[model samples]
Target: MAQRLVFPDAYAAADLITFAGRAARAGDGAVHLRASGGTLVTAAAPLLRQGLLDSTPTIIGMRLLPVDPELDCDLVVEAALLQIAHDDAEAVELPETAVPPPLWSAAEVPRSGWSHAGTLDLAVLAERAQWGMSAVAHALPIDPGDLIVQAVRGKIWSAPDEDLGGLPRGVAFVARTLGFIGEDAEDVGVRTCGRWTRLTLRRGHVLLRGPAHLGMTEVRETGHVAALVD
Candidate 1:
């Protein structure tokens, strides 16, 4: 039986990248950030970190490749271990073992602008996730339905008065719920995108941001409630 993990949002990809980049950096490994066919490998934490943070929120396919053929089977295992340790990830998938080598590599790489694939996991990613979440949660709170937004350009915005500071409690809760955290309050922003509300913040604002997509409903649902009230 093959397990399929579908991440139908860009935020999901960004989350993976951030998790992977941090793991790679911490282990003194390298990360190659390529969208189509351009392999831009770098070891700079700031650059890779920013790439993960600034990624547009959309759905893209991600395939994890192994650095070596012998390590192929351990790809998913490594990802799970990273998630368990980091607490910044939820799920991952493994490729079919019987697939042809060339095709497997091809599918793992993104084409045009549809999906992306790569390999990582040379170090202990779990600890990085744990520490990152701790740092983020320490600064904010976590809540269901909170929209994680980024502060495109600004400083720490004072938490709103009236107990609406928008921060959450646990770092793991925030990591599991909001894909990424901002560096500070001013770097976080909560906004609604289409049907899904997004919490856009820097890598550090994980806790300080709050939900921005409450009470939202489709036109049909809204009309039904209106009729009932009338």
Candidate 2:
């Protein structure tokens, strides 16, 4: 089961508001913005007019069903604030009202394993590298491949083409973007939590190791590899 997130006051206002706007435009229903007393004074009016704010500002004894229940409420709130900052409301607030327990439980809660943590895909990473390299290519003489390797963290693992999703027990690439020791013209060492199995790759191969296994295609689309057992 995924864990439940109790939104803080900061999230309640800013993030919720932003999400409200996007959802409203998409016809996904309004995001409920609840508050008490004077907190909603300036905040509630504009949001209400935009139809982003729920007409009712009191969830005192009500329950909520988050579509992405496992999503970090804070992140959603942050996204919302980023979206609505240009609007009339400069700040968001949470009233002193009480919130009710969840009326309906989510089908599944987000898990707390390395496999469930955030990761990036090669393509997105490549795009980021392209953007960064474009910006500093003149000042810094570097290779795109080097930049991509530098961007990735932890360990990299590879598998036999047939056993891609099978159990992993092999040496993998270990690159460090943070706390980089020095700059040199040498391939970084590969590390792994398990033993190595004989596997063949084409000419060049990058080893990835985590409690997950993500393919190039999946990464390009979803931004990360598939999570596997640790």
Candidate 3:
């Protein structure tokens, strides 16, 4: 069975990218990252270590996707052996198999202008809004009762002061500005959008200096783990 592992938020996706990429480097398996077609990252290997993706991990960002209660998982290795071996029967030999790499892809933005991880990735959202605020604004609802605003405030204040330092700058900035509602609701909404840029320093969400593939060297140097397998 092809398993559908959904990352509830952008931070969650970044976490898997770091962990799986590191796992491959440490002889856990192979990992690849592709920026094309949704910034895909995949790790194809049996996790030598156990309990890596367990429990509801603390997410610092709003989740674009639905949450899964039973986060406990043991991605079985041997169960996939036969299918992997069968790949050899094809005319072209099966190059890689059996090892199921932990995978992550940037989920598309939802109807509510919500995102799984990259949803609020500030640059893209802001640029789009700048290009045509009217179009983007139609999709995102900004009111005191909005879910995004509440989620952002809840995540930031709930965490300890020391832990808050590690959050993405954009997110932290938004959290800091909380309760300072602007005279206009639209202005307040824009403020929330401004603070939601991608945070790549501690995690694997990095801005590429040059081409996406070449940029991965920076990620590798940072000891950030991630991969994209075609």
Best by TM-score: 1
1-230: candidate 1 lDDT, tens digit per residue: 44433233445544555555453432123222222122111111111112344421221112232121122121222221222112223333333432222211222221122111111111212234354445445545455222232321111122211122232222223332233433322222323323322222233212121233233222121111110011
* Highest-lDDT candidate: 3
**Residue-wise lDDT of candidate 3 within 1-230, one digit each (tens)?**
34333444545454443344343343234333222222333322221112343211112221121223443332323221212112222111112333443332132212133112211233432333233324324444666354553344333322322222223222323221211112322111111112232333222232211111111111112332212110
lDDT per residue, candidate 2, 1-230, as tens digits?
Answer: 22222333445445445434443342112223322322221111111111232221110001122222233331112112223232234333333232232221111222222222122322332333244334434444455563343222111212222122332212111111111112322222211233221111111112332333333222112222222112
Quantify how close model 3 is to the true structure by its C-alpha RMSD in Å. 19.3
Evaluate model 2: give its TM-score. 0.21
Please list the residue runs of candidate 2 whose C-alpha ends up more than 4 Å from where it truly belongs after superposition. Answer: 1-12, 30-105, 114-213, 216-230
Q: Which stretches of candidate 3 lie over 4 Å from their true place?
A: 1-95, 101-198, 202-230
Q: Is candidate 1 or candidate 2 better by lDDT?
A: 1
Candidate 2 lDDT (Cα, 0 to 1): 0.25
> Candidates' TM-scores?
0.23, 0.21, 0.21
Better of 1 and 3 by lDDT: 3
TM-score ranking, best first: 1, 2, 3
Question: What lDDT would each prediction earn against the true structure?
Answer: 0.27, 0.25, 0.27
